[model samples]
Structures are given as structure tokens and as C-alpha cells.
Target chain A: MNKILTIMWKDVRVLFQDWAAVALIIAGPLVLALGLGLVTGAFSNSDAPTIGRIPVVLVDEDGGQLAAALVDVLTSDDLSDLLAVETLSDADAARARVAAGDASAAVLIPTGFSDSFTPDMATGEMPASVTVTVVGDPGAPVGAAVVRSIVEEFAARADTAVAGVRVGLTQLAGSGAVSPVELPAVGQSMAAAVFADSAAASAASVIRVETRNVTATGESFNILAYFAPAMALLFLMYAVTLGARTLLSERREGTLARMLAAPVSSAQVLGGKVGGIFLGGFIQLAALILLTTLLWQLNWGNPLSVLLLVVAAALAATGWGLLIASLAANAGQITSLGMALTLLFGILSGSFVPLNDAWPVLDWLSRITPNRWAMDGFVALAAGEGGAAVLVPVAALLVMAAVLFAAAALFFRRRQGALLTA
Target chain B: MTTPILIAKDLRKTFGDLEAVKGISFSVLRGEIFSLLGPNGAGKTTTINMLSCLLPPTAGTAEIAGHAIPGDTLGVRRAIGVVPQEIALYDALSARQNLEFWGRLYDMRGQALTQRIDEVLEQVGLADRAKDKVKTFSGGMKRRINIAAGLLHKPQLLFMDEPTVGIDPQSRRRILDMVKELRDGGMTVLYTTHYMEEAEELSDRVGIIDQGRLIALGTQAELTRVVGEQETLRLYLAEEAGAAAAQATVAAGDGAALPADGGLTLFNGLPGVLRASAIDHQIVVNVADAGEALPAVVGRANALGLHVRSVDIEEPNLEAVFLQLTGRGLRD
Candidate 1:
């Protein structure tokens, strides 16, 4: 135990002396967290109506009074301020525009739209409704819904005005002295008058939607939260690599053979090396977490759980490093193997990208990686739930660490005999 | 004297089918610097490693400091220290730190560890540079630290395998002197080196190894006597002495003429003939038996108008003895 502590102390001293290692372990995470936070912030605040523009397309097919009235309504300064409408000559062109994402939606008006809304037409049969076709990226459901709201309001106003016009016409006919020519002229005037009244009523009925996002928990996802954990894991890998490099250096310098010549047992030497690597990895993890918290306001809830996860993750990482170093004959072999393992495990662990709903095979493979379990624990803790749930994964990580460390120790002991002979 | 500090009775080690040490046996008495002198690939290191408990001999038993090796490896390790051929100090750590760390490994702690570290540092003449990192140290300084680390525990037996290879002349001499000093201070040392001079200078008794076998073992005088009573005589002749002049000079010496070849010829005993050089007018003669014939040979050469240059007569040393026994140079 004393020997292990001595080895750990030496490793810590070396880590503190290296400036580049300090920066990568601490500052790198904070920078990443800040950047991710700002991006999430920009995405959430995009729904405000402050001179912001939403692209829309106008498809007017009627070329008549009512179609013109609808276009005029859409082009008014008040609506234009919220939306940027591009006029398309035909429905086909507007659909193409929306499909290609050139605009958010297409408003189509049928031919003879004004005639369809007559008093006789309203009472005898229901007029064909003008369709507002919104073709949009399904991922942007909010934008599509906003466009639909505007069209729905416009339709309601048009319906009420048509009903009023039909009632007035019926009253005029009850007077019993109207001529047929005067009736056509009155119908035309009535149609024009109804369109104007409906436009006014629609304008008055326009309800501006104000969106307020509320969550039960007030936690905001920031860059620090997103990148702090990842950077911690990355630096943990680097610490392992550094420790492996030390092993190679000792072998090259023949110090390993000299150590074998001492009274210390092979097991003791192996234990010392593993302890050193674990200590370095722990330092890196702590620095990353602390820097992320202080610099970018990263929230790592349940400190005890986080601490446990970090320890498990460090052990697993250091074990992997020692195993690689033991198998490798030289520094180059150690480096190549270390890099391959780190990248393979890091990707599977979802350090760089989310793998929540990944393929079933990938999910199973991730369970075998300590990094995956560690990242899951961190994300769960930071998201403020699943405290007891994280214990299984953390234990799995520790088991993996123990298995790797044992394998490394066995390899080192076997090699010690060969090294001594050499 | 009681148990013989280390004993290897027919110790053998094999790599695959090739035997590195072939049933070699030797013993080191307490407080003696015993050397294993050999060329490259002569199993000297293999023997040392087995005795040091770093390797288990393939077919024989050895005891280190009264403890059986391999069976009681820990006991052997505790009683012995090893200074390998290669430098073994950590580069990142200071000399003091390295010593302290190694000392702690041997269970030396507190002020005792510090005191031992200081003593070893002073003995190796590295006390002043103890605070400096080993990477900044010279080859000799690193070698000294390597030796110091081995001595931190003050073991009864020390195994030094080619400890002075590729070092400066001064450092090599210092190390040789230190080995002698250590032996004098009551530590049994098994020193191995390819350099015949180092073995001849420092070893109380030398074991000459070749082809994984001990070819010869004895004191310097005892080994030199192996070449028999014949002495080697060298004559430093003037450059102007032609082959004929050299040949005539050898014939004139009071030794039996054997053959006349190259620039000169050898005589079985002494020749009574002389010839003079053209430029310096000098004559040189070399004889196999110089002691009985030197005075007569010198007189005859001077009477025959031959100016004698210089003469040296000495018995065959280890180098000659080795060459005669192996039909090859000691270094080769």
C-alpha cells in the first residue's frame, strides 16, 4: 500500500508539472460547454416575434375579386412583419417551392372564389373551401402550425361575412318590388361589400400567439453540460496514454529490469504502475469537472454519484492503458493501440454523439464499454433523475476496470520474467 | 569462509536448444571481488542473472548469500544487489529522489533511508548533484547513480554485470577503484567485464569465460604462469633497419634461429650474428628466452657495429595466455 501510494504521488507530481496536460484536462471542457450552451440557447429562443421573418409562398389561382382580396389581406404590413410572403403564379409552382423548402407554405385560392360565396350558393350548397397547403419539413412542426393558424383565422372571418350577406339579401327580396337587373347589380355590390366587411372582421379577429416555454425543472442545457463530461473522458484517455508512455520509457531505459532486480515482487510493481495511472486519470477527471463547473456553470447534480462515476471511469481507462502498454513492445505500438482503443470505446460510449436510440447491437456493445456506462451516469445525474438507476452501470464500469487491471497485472508479471532474462 | 557467500554448482541455463551457461561451477568467498571475464555471448551475464535470482537456472541449483536461488528468490533478493550493464535511473526524477525511491523499495525508511541515500550519494561522488534530474546527468553520473541504487540496501553480495562499458577512461578507472574499495569494505562482488585490464586490476581472483564455459580461473600470477617459462622480448628498431638488417640482427642474437620472415624473425634461444642499418646504422633483435641470453646478445650486437635501440623482456600475461588458449584475441 505504501509502495502504491508512492507511485501515485509520483504520477500526480508529473501531471501537475506538465502545462499542456493541465490545460487539456481543465480548460478544454469549459470551452466546449460554453459553445454547446450558446447553440442550444439560440435554438430555443427562435420563436419570438421581434422583426424575425418566416418564409411563406402565396398561390393565387382565382385571378378574381375574392382571390385578390385574400392576397391583399396576406400582404398587409402587419402580417408581412411576421412573415415574408413570396407570390407564386400557380399552385404547382408554390407546391414545388414549399417542397424544396424555398418557402414555409402555399396558400391556394380556387377559380371563381368570389362567386362561390353568394347568398344563394351559401343556402343551397356549401361553397368549395379554398385550401391552404402547407408543405414543410416535418421536423419543423412549429413553423407549419404557425402558418396553419393564419389561414384558419382568415377562413373564419370569410364564413361569417358570407352568412351576413346572405341574410341581408333575403330581407331585400322580402320587400317584393326588386327588378331582376337590379338584383344582379345588388349581388355584385353585395359580394364586394361582404369581401370588405370580412377582411375588416378577419383583421380584427387576428390573434397573435405568444409562446412561453415552461418546464417543471428550470435547468437549462449549456455548452458546459454538453462538453464537460466528454472532455473529462477524453482527458482521462490522455492520462492513460501518458501512463502507458511511462511504462514504455521505463522499459526502454532498462529501469524496469532494474526494478525487477530489487526486493520488490512482480505483483507489487504491477500494482504500483496501475495505481499511478489511476491517480493521474482521477486528477484529469477532477480538473475537467471543476473547470467546467466554475467556468461554464455546468450543473452536475448528485455530487456523490458523479464522484463515484468518475472513479469507476478512471479505473477502467487506466486499466485499459496498462493492458495496452503491457502488450506493446515499444512506444509506437503502445500509441497506435491506445489511440484505436480510445476512439473505438469513446465513440461507442456516445462521448461525441448521442446514442440513445442507436441500433440494438450498438446498444449492447456500448454496455461493455466503461465510457458508455460513465457517460450514461453523468447524463442522468446532470439531467436530475435516475440516481439509484445509475448504480448498476457504475458497478459494471468498476467490474470492467477490475477485469482489465487484473489482465494487465498478469501480463506484466509474466513479462517481468522475460525482461529480467533479457 | 563459513558458507561461501554464493555457490553455483554446475549451474546451467538454456534458451530453446542452445545452452547459454553449460554446467559452470564457482564460489565466491566473503569480502572478495570475483570477476567473470568473457567476450560477448559468453554466458557471464546469464550466470550472474541466475545467481541474482533474476533468472532460474535450467538444470542446476545455486545459493546466494546462503539462500537458495529461485526457491527462496525473495530471500536471495533481499540479500543481494544488482548493478546491470545498462543505465537504470529514472530520467524525470532527481538523483536523490531516485535513490530515495529505490531505498524505500528495500524497506529503508525515514531518516535511515535519507542517511543511506546520503552515504551512497557521497560514496558515488554524486552528493553535490543529487538535486539535478538524471536526464541532465552525464553517462558516468548516471552509471554512478545506477551503482548507488544497488548499494542503498547494503546487501551482502553485489552483482555488477559489465558495469563500466562505454564510459570515459577516468570514469572507468573510478568504477574499477570503487569496486576494489567495496570489496575491501567487506562486500562480496561478482564483477563481470569484457575488458581484461579491469579484471586484472580489480579482481582478487578472475574467472575467464568463453563459449558459455569457464576456460580459466585463478590469481593474476597463477594465470600468467599458464604460458610456461618462455618470456617475450620486444626490440624497438630504427625505421632505417631493412629486412636483411633485422634478420641479421636476430641471427646475431644469442638465440637459436628458427625462421627469417617478414621484417624480422624469431629465435628459439639466441643467435650470435649482427648486421647494421643503412640510415641510422642500428640493429634490433627479439628473443624468446631473454633472461639467460640478454647480456651475451647485447655484447655481440655492439661488437658487430649494430646500434641497439631498446629491449623489453616480460612473461606472458592474461592477454597472451588467452590468445594461446583460445587461438583468438581476448576482446574478439
Candidate 2:
């Protein structure tokens, strides 16, 4: 262990001693993340052009007032550019339209849906909720997901508006602002208007512009949050791979041969090299995580969970690094192979962009990369899902570490007869 | 006299069909410098590598500091230090760091490692440059640090393989001096070099090797005795007039091929001339006296109508012994 630490310390010292390398490894990822976050974050601005319209089929089974108002809200002039709504009479036709790819989603409003959400409901009494069934298309999930979000937002706002109308109209009548005979009509009309227009537009107009942390959402600043950690993980592989490449470089420089000539065992030498790569990768990631937190205001996840994932992620990355080193004959080969693998795995695992879930092949390919598991872990942790929520990702990361380390060690030993030296 | 610090009997190494080190056997006496003298690719470095534990021999029985090879590799390594043919110090690290790292590998730490580093730095005359990065230093300075690294643990035996292969005169002198200093301080040294002068100047005993085999081994004086008391007479003729007409010029051992001046043939009949051979424009005459041999050598050259550029007398030495044993110069 002492020898391992000594080797680790020597490599670490060499890493930090070159200030250019230090700046590039630590600051390069931060600068890149910020640039990407800003570029991607720009599109999420509220004032920017909204996405294209989603084709939606609406089937109102209930000829009631509440169901009619909800259809009016979805087809209102304000959402005319965002949602291409088709009012269909047959529920089977609406379902077929979604299934046949004619529409992104079909919204079915069952009978008695409007009855439970009427303005005549007693004040201070809980209102009976309704379930809006939205059948979405498998081919066009993005459009379907957008339509589903707008509908859910409308339901939440409409529920709030309906409950407030009853108590407010009575108060207004008592205060003499409105005549008692016309108060009920005024409350119904206001509730109807609330359900007629764009609830999302109104919500957006309420909040002032401000930057916030990265979360897996479509908020104004969520892109920055999404990209910052993803970019950090992507570039972290380069830093750690460079650290691993040093094992080959040391051999080229003859330091490894010199070390072997000493009283130290080959196992100790390789252990030190492996330790250096693991720690270097860990330090690079931890620094990036901290930097994003302090400067970009991006929260990675639960601190302990991030720490645990970072350790496992570094180990797994180092395993790849050693594997690259083991296969490489020299530092130059390692550098080329390491950088190539870094970019290949980074892009493959959806570090730059999400893998298309519709494509099972790409998803399967992504599972083979450390980036996928690491990103999944970070995503879960960032969602504030600490504790047991992180179990699978953490376990996956450990498994990756174990399997890759074993493979790398086996190849490295075959090449150099060392514990982990490449 | 002194108990042998290192002994090998029938050490051999084969790489595929090629035998890198053929059945070779030699030993190093305590506190003595044993120089393995050979040209490049002569298996000198291979032999050093085998003994250094860098490579395992195909077949051998050897022990260093009472530890056997193969069976006690770590023990053998613990008892010996190696300054390889290449400067093996970390270039980016400071001299002190390089020393410290190597020292730690030897399991030396605390004040002992530090003191040893200081001592080695002082010994190699690089004390002032200890804090400087090795890459920033000159080649000579880097070589010193490399040597310093090997000496940090102060093993019982040191293997210096062609340590001064490429260096300026001053640096080479310092390293050779350092080797002698190490020997004088009671350390066994096995130095290998293609440079005959370095071997003759520094080694107590010389092992002449060629083509993966040690051809000859003895002290400089003992090896030189192979040529007896006869001195070598060199005739430097024009290249066109040399090895081409060397036979005509030497005129055989009895001077029968040379033109006769009156009744006596022009060369070999001289009292000092013992034997003669022709090699590349140089007619080599082994004689009892160089002064008496010079006139006869010039007379023979004139009789053969070959132009004699100059004459030189080479005393019996390791170079001559190597040439005498292998029929080739040591540099070949």
C-alpha cells in the first residue's frame, strides 16, 4: 500500500507539476461545459421561438361544459401555433389517428368529467379529480410528450381556477362590486375563460428571467445544467486517459525500467500506476463537479452520491485507460488510441446528446460504454434521488469498474508482467 | 583471494534460434572492477542484463552476494545496482525527486533516504544541481543523476553497462574517475564497454567477448602476454597500395617475395623480425625490437615497390591481445 501510494503520489505530482496540463484538465472541462450550457441554454429562453406544433386528436365523450372548455383551451388562438388540434367525434377514430401516426396524441374526455369540476361545488370541500387519458404515438414521442405536458399544465391551472371562483364570486356580490343575481354567471364565465386560453403562456409571463441550476427539465436554464455535467464526464475521460497514457510514457522514458531495477516488486510498480490513474481521474471529476457547482450554479446531485459515483466512475475510466495502455506499444499509440476512445465512447454514450430511445440498437450500444452508466448515475443523483435511488447506477458503475479493471490488468500483465502497468 | 561477490557457471540465453549469450562463465572478486570488453552486439549488454535480472537466462547457475539467480531474483536485485546503457532517470523530475523515488523503491526512507541521496549527489559531484530538473540539465549532468540514482541504495555490487558511450571528454573522464572512486571505496564493479582504453584504464580484469561468447578473460598484462614480448610494426601505406599488395610487400616470412639487394633478400632476415602478416595496407611485423624492425619493414616496402607512408610500433596490450585472439580489432 505504501508503494502504491508512493507511485500514485509520483504520478500525481507529475500531473500537477505541469501547470499547462493541470489547467487544461481542470479548466478545459469547465470552460467547455459553460460554453455548451450557454449555447444549449439559449434555446430554452422563454422569448425564443417555440418548437413546431404537435398534432393532437381530441374526443369529447362528455357533452358537458368542463370538457368543452378544456377543448377550447387546447385549441385556443394562443396555442394555435403550438398545437395542431383535430376535434374528432369517435373515440375509436381518435385512438386510430394516434396509432396510425396521424396525430402525436389522442386526448379522451370520458362522461361526467365536467360534472366533477363544476363551479357549483361547495367551498372548502375537496373536488373530485378527473383522469385525462392521453394515448401517445410510439414514433413521435417528442411531440406526444409535449402535448401531454401542456394538457397536464392546463389541468393543474384549471383545477385551481375552478375552486377559487366559487368563494370569490360570493365575496364580490357581498362587497357590492357585482349584483347578486349576476354573480354566478360571472364566476362561470371567468372559469370558462381561464380554461379557454394558454395556461403555459400565462405561467411563462409570470416568472422573471433568472438563471438556475441544471435539472432534467425543459426550463430556461436546464440545458446548461444538462450539458455542464455531461460535458464534464465526457472530457473527464480524456484527463484520466492522459493519466493512464503516462504509464506507457514512463516506460518509454525508461523510468519504469529504472523502477523495476530497484528493490520494488513488479506488482508494486503496477499497483502504483493503476492507483495514479484512478486518483487522477477522481480528482479531475471532483474538481469539475465542484467547479460547476461554484461557478455555473449547476448541482450534480446528492453530495455523497456524487462522491460515490465519481469514485466508481473514475475507477471505471481508469480501467479503460489501463486497457488502452496495455494494448498500446508506446505513449504515442496510447495517446492516439486514448483520445480516439474518449471521443468515440463520449459520443456513443450520449454524452453530447441523448441516445434515441426509439432505436434499440443505439441504446444497446450505449449500454456498453461507461459514459452511459456514469451519465445515468449523475442524472439520477441530480434529480435529488439519493439513498436507494442511486443503487442501480452505483452498482452498474462498480461492475463496470470491476470488469474493466480485470480485463485491463490481465492484458497489462501479459504485456509487462506487472500488476497494472501497461 | 577475496571471496567472489558474483559467480556464474555456464550462463546462457537464447532468443528464439539466436543465442544472445552463449555458455559464458565469469566471476567478480570483492572490491575489484571486472570489465567486459566487446564491440557492439557482442553480447556484453545481454550478459549484463541477464546478471541485472532484467532478463532471465535460458540456462545458468549464478549467485550474487550469496543469492542465486532465478530462484532468488529479488535477493540478487537487492544486492546489486545497475546503471543501464541508457540514462534511465526521470527527465521531468528534479534530481532529488528521482533519487528519492528510486530510494523509496529500495525501501529506504526518512532521514536515511535523504542522507543517502545527499551522499550520492555529492559522490557524483552533482550536489549543487540536486534541486534542478533532470531534463533541464545537460546530458552529462543527466548521466550523473542516472548514476546517482543507482548508488542511492549502495548495493554490494554495481553493473555499469557502457555508461560513457556517448558523452563529451570531460564527462567521460568524470564517470571513469567515479567508477575508480567507487572501486577504491570497496565496492565490486562489473563494467562493460567497447572502448578498449577505458577497460585498460579502469578494470582490474578484462573479459573479451565476441558474437555472444566471452573469447578471453584475464588482467590486461596477462592477456597481453598472449603476444609474448614481440612488438607490432605497422606500415601505413596508401589504400591502393595496402591490403591489395600487402602480400607482395611483406614478401612472406623469409622475405622470399621481396626483391633481393645483392645476395640478401630485403626484409624478414633482420634479427628483430619474428613473423609477418598483411592486413589492409598495413604490413604487421612481430619483432623483438621496434627500432630494429622499422628499417626492415621500410626495406621490404621499398623492395615490393609499395610507398611506405609511416611506421608505428604498438606495444603489447589488451587491444593487441584481443586482435591476436580474434583476428579483429576491439572496435570491430
Best by DockQ: 1
lDDT string for model 1 (A1-422, tens) is 77666666766666665667677656665565555444434334543211135677887777665566667666766555556888878878877776676765667776766667653422334456655444553323224434655565566666777777666666776775555446555655776765655543434443222111101232333334544686578657867887877777766777776777777776666667778888888878887787667754567878888888889898888878988987988888887887787778767765554443223477688877767778767765765544784797689888998898789878877876664344
- Estimated TM-score for each candidate: 0.66, 0.72
- Write one digit per residue (lDDT tens) for candidate 1, span B1-332: 34588888899899899999998988888888888988878999889878876778898888877688659888998999989888977777789988887887788899999999999999999999999988899898888999999999999999999999888998988888888889888898999988877888888888888888998888878887776654544344554445434556555672344222222233223452121112133233333456666776666546544456876664666655665456444554
Candidate 2 per-residue C-alpha lDDT over A14-127 given as tens digits, one digit per residue, 9 for 90 to 100: 887777888888887777766754554334554532335679999999866667666766776556656789999998899889879798788899886865665542343334
> For every candidate, how close is chain A to the native chain A in TM-score?
0.57, 0.61
Chain B TM-score, all predictions listed: 0.77, 0.82
What are the lDDT figures for the candidates, one per model?
0.69, 0.74
Off by over 4 Å in 1: A7-219, A245-249, A353-365, A406-416, A419-421, B1-3, B229-315
Give one digit per residue, the lDDT tens place, for model 2 in B232-285: 776777764334453553554544543321111234577787655454556566
Worst 10 residues of 1 chain A by lDDT: A207-216
